[model samples]
Target: MQIFEAIIGHVEKRCEAKGKRLTTQRKLVLRALIDANQALSAYELVDYCKQYFGETIQAMSVYRILEFLEEVHLVHKLNMSNKYIVCSHIVEGHEQGIPQFLICSKCNKISEKIVAPETITGLQSHARQEGFTVVSPQLEINCVCDKCGQ
Candidate 1:
């Protein structure tokens, strides 16, 4: 539980720094995401909040909370899986280089890591050559995780 508290504290600090409000409902939704062992869709989050917090959250509310969290960089939305994960940097109190997510295609488990700056620069250069702008630096690569690979 200490880990959750630390993450929550970091998020609170971030929200304060950004002049945003972390409402109770938003906190509950964020807590549910943080407690989850894997990424969860907003519908799954609704069920989780109901089961764990006794709060019957609607999908729309959860999505709004998720959007707010993402806006503050407290959570990340995995486009491929249509799920969300808390930003790994929250625990460290600072972000490193470009963040990348390695996702297990089978189980949808996600692991966050930082890729070297040169790697991203290379990809950006390649995109520029193709006349495509690199909007977000985040990358999500799908493959089977070790546990699932076994």
Candidate 2:
């Protein structure tokens, strides 16, 4: 609980730094994600808000809030699963690099990592050779977590 509050504070400060306000609705959405501690689809988030807060939040509103959170680097969207997770580095106050997500296929648990810049450069180079452009630097790898693997 202490850690969650700290993360929320950090995110609030970050948003303020960008001249943006983390409104109550946004905080509720963020809290839902933090409490779940896993990637969640916008619809799932809406259900969470309804279940936990007894508040009705539209999926479209959740998506817009998520977009704002992503813009502030407080959340990340997993392209592979079309789910959103709070950024892992928020509490650490670390500068973000290109994010890569290791997703547990069975449980949908996600581990976020910052890939080495050189590795991303190599991938971009390879893509360029194929006459392709790298649109987003985020990468998602599907795997089974140790517990699930066992």
Candidate 3:
């Protein structure tokens, strides 16, 4: 994918398969995720929501929708920041893999990098050996990008 968005063809197939409604609120939330191009806390999402979804939607409503989207693998949440972002690859065709987050500490921009299947498998196996099953490795580190470093 180019970044944070659904390939419309793929998303439509998924929605049909799941029998889920892509309500206006869901579209609004997804748009905000795409536009922000970063992990966004629900509160931040709500701030954007007011513009299109109106003041009627409480934060909890947004959270509920986000929760549903995540459960269905339409979006992924980075627990490190307790924020959500659109998955780079929207389809989880084969019980696939967790998407890794490349987050900028200085500007808070995020880039989703698809971890290789071998890497995820090895990590999961290692975690299982330690009696811990790791779900997200959206690691946050302190560093500046070349532009920021300059």
TM-score winner: 2
Candidate 1 lDDT at 61 equals 87
Q: Every model's Cα RMSD, please?
A: 1.8, 1.2, 3.8
Best by lDDT: 2
Model 2 steric clash pairs: none
Question: What is the alpha-carbon lDDT for the whole of candidate 2?
Answer: 0.90
What digit string (tens of lDDT, one per residue) describes model 1 on residues 1-150? Answer: 897787777778878877998898998988998888778899999999999989998899899989998887778888877889888776565655778999888888788998899999999999999999999888999889999999
Clashing pairs in 3: none
TM-score of each: 0.88, 0.94, 0.76
Cα error, residue 52 of model 3, in Å, equals 6.0
Worst-scoring 10-residue span by lDDT in model 1: 88-97
**Higher TM-score: candidate 2 or 3?**
2
Residue 72 of model 1, lDDT score? 77
lDDT per residue as tens, model 3, 1-150? 354345545665687777977676776787777776677889999997777447456798889989987877778887767889887666555553556776767887677676787887887799899999776654444456666667
TM-score, model 3 to reference? 0.76
Model 1, total clashes = 0
Instruction: Report the candidate with higher lDDT, 2 versus 3.
Output: 2
Each model's lDDT comes to 0.86, 0.90, 0.73
Candidate 2, residues 1-150: lDDT per residue as tens digits? 787788789888887877999999999999999998888999999999999889999999999999998988889998887889999887665668999889989998888889999999999999999999999978999999999999
Q: In model 1, what is the error at residue 61, expressed in angstroms?
A: 1.7
